[model samples]
Target: MARSLTAAIFATALGFSACLLNAAPAQAATGTITGLAGKCLDVAGANSADGTAVQLYDCNGTAAQQWSVGSDGSIRALGKCLDVTDNSTGDGAKAQLWSCTGGPNQKWSVSAAHDIVNPQANKCLDVTGNNSANTTRIQIWSCSGGANQKWNAPAGGDDGTPSGFVVTEAQFNQMFPNRNSFYSYSGLTSALSAYPGFAQTGSDTVRKQEAAAFLANVSHETGGLVYVVEQNTANYPNYCDWSQPYGCPAGQAAYYGRGPIQLSWNFNYKAAGDALGVDLLNNPWLVQNDSAIAWKTGLWYWNTQSGPGTMTPHNAMVNQAGFGQTIRSINGSLECDGRNPAQVQSRVDAYQRFTQILGVSAGGNLYC
Candidate 1:
């Protein structure tokens, strides 16, 4: 009898360990990206072909402007990223998106030089004579190797590269504000208080690891610093309506999927609310400010309760490993397909960039 009881206890412990291991990895809280905001972009079109209008929007979970920062330090978006626009060496030439031909234009080298010059264009991504002011639009100009052309990615800014780009803190904040903190979702305390599960994770190595994983996942989902100023209602109808008590109204059933994880659909909102103890039907902004709750909403689909054996956050990532696709599903995307090799590789590269910072290696494979 004693031996049988001991075996049962060991089996229960093993089951508990397995359950904990299956939980999503928490992401670290990355600080604001210092000076590479303008370099990032969104797809903003149905077909991600050549000449798609790659616009500069704040990364707020939209599929249009999501990007991948390559280890070689190239910025990729919309299948293709910002290249030197055919490697021109003339002034007034507009920077356009092109196929990842791996030419000199696409092959950017972020060196101790800090000069992001395109030999194809003979121009550098300059800062208007190096003036770090508000709303300072970056321009491509002659590559004289001046300080203005020289960029530095600061020690904290994890752009994968060791050196490149620098901007004022205020300007950087404008480019990348704390998502939930910026929208003001009745203070961080409310969101934290609403979800005790996250708090129970504890503030040790486990919590930090989880935070890093969560932040990295969401940042990838929301397009990093590029999505700092997106319209909350752009994806969902009642997404921004605070006046609604138990959802938008009789006719407004489409107002779901908001915040970093794009918490959408009434079913999803109520489900997340049930888990986090917040009325997500009424307060959708909780997905941003409250890190714990935000993660809860993002992870709600992971459990079998929502939809068993179907495409969910955990299963999709474990299999597909594309951040863009995960967000596209939650927000109802028409153009952004995360299953593409280019898209998946781009995000995988970004994940590698962060892991490099954290000093971990998947041994060439991102999926560990």
Candidate 2:
């Protein structure tokens, strides 16, 4: 009797296991994605271009608006992957329609709160500027759990100008309204394009932080991007870096601090010019004369040089090493360790303001 009872119990357990194994998997969802003020995710003008903008528009139940969320971790519309531009994980990076290649940037996950997040950047798909108007571009930003970052995906297909920089022309003007004539926004934009990854090295938050850090340094270096060249004539001839074989072909005094970051020294000019495909070594004057070249030199320094710090300023920001490290990276020997507290405070003040303007937290470690 005992053996028979045990046998029956074993049979029942086996049947339950079989039932569990036979259960069907959940189906992938398809629907319209609605967000902020009832705007829908839209393909711009229903165009099929690879880089076509994914924007916010009025919900009209068009084929262009249809989207499906796949179990493969992709949100698809019009048979193309909703992709981050250049597979970039940086904040303010644009999102567009692209051929599905199974890239990480193409992967997205809908959260319990209905935020469509890019796992690669660990950020949310956001409507730029939170504007509900038609044709507002979509972008990736730090997941703030804000209404703009929330989305209703799998029930819909959803979705700027300012080609290079994320900040608008108006904002740029506000930042440097009375700046020097040599600081051209168009020129800076054009130059930044040459290095597609400049100031966009990591997640969206990091990108914005790095931009603020760089600009803050620039503000300190050039007095609000006003001076094209260093004002102290005494230091002009000291930047020759005589160890270089090519020497200061543009004359010893020509290598003074110039441009947004105030690039200095003969070797720096050569390195910046070579990297940008310009002849800055022989024509160091171009650093001050041409707006684009000037900006490029500044970016070259920001992206490449470590100065006194162990890592480049770009790396410092991207690695979450704090703004103080960036100051050290740029001029640690002179400014760090309470050596120049006022100068350090100035950069930190600019960073604070810029972060507020950027709609992100300033993060920790403000000083070296």
Candidate 3:
């Protein structure tokens, strides 16, 4: 919940992370990568020969499909690495078996959205032409966040609600029964692609706690999600800071609070928009008008900004530093340290209720 103080300033623009994966554990896991049409990613004909094609096949209990996602970012099987043929980064560059060379071409990242990406190519491991045949080849293609690009790789957290989101639509409605139609479940889930690590790190309890903490703050900020834009119009004109090189381009009063986090300030609009490729500085009203964009702004702040605290809110919950740290990160200057105990309690109560809904303990350090 970005408040009016300079403390509310959300910082930096992350266009796309170098790797969308959470940091791999000391020993990355070895398993079969299930892909399109429920097939296993396989080495063609179970052959170990160099340059053998990597394709999709029925899930047989065979060593040909057995593979490992290494901590160093290599996918290995059949004593060879999954390689982009000839080290090409171009789209449609086919994947094949090659001896492990520790080259950039073989580097890949599996993200929270179930997409396996080749970072060097900035592309997803795609089924050629979206085919479901047994021998359909694998290739690198521009990431579209499509099902064709998704993979059920090792190391996924089972934190999602029944709808494959951290929070179910039913739970969301229960949390914000009076929430405006502007905040849609689909919109929020769609925005998760921008920051793959949110609610995806650490143990299952930690994941649920992180989700609860973020939404608790959002629930308080929006008054149980009833407000789409800031209710206090008096602060509309006050949010525009004149010192930035790109002065308030959306007019002085346009940068007021909006979205789940009620993101405000000219610099914050620029930062969130730039990070999301949305041009929010000029079209600041989009946060209130577009549900997905509105949700994206909130995620952008949660995942990237430290605000008045030492770490981002995402880090606070994942590191098990308690929900109090999230409150400090968001509005400590005005609300924490007994300056405004009532407001902090409002946030904590929501955290407790939300965690109960999630079937998890609220954990320690309930207040700042």
**Which ten-residue region of model 3 has the weakest summed lDDT?**
9-18
Give each prediction's root-mean-square deviation over alpha carbons. Answer: 22.9, 20.5, 8.6
Candidate 1 segments whose C-alpha is farther than 4 A from its true place: 1-212, 225-235, 238-256, 285-296, 299-338, 363-368
Better of 2 and 3 by TM-score: 3
Who wins the TM-score comparison?
3
TM-score, cand. 1: 0.35
Better of 1 and 2 by lDDT: 2
Candidates sorted on lDDT, descending: 3, 2, 1
lDDT of 3: 0.78
Q: Estimated TM-score per prediction? A: 0.35, 0.60, 0.68
Off by over 4 Å in 2: 1-161
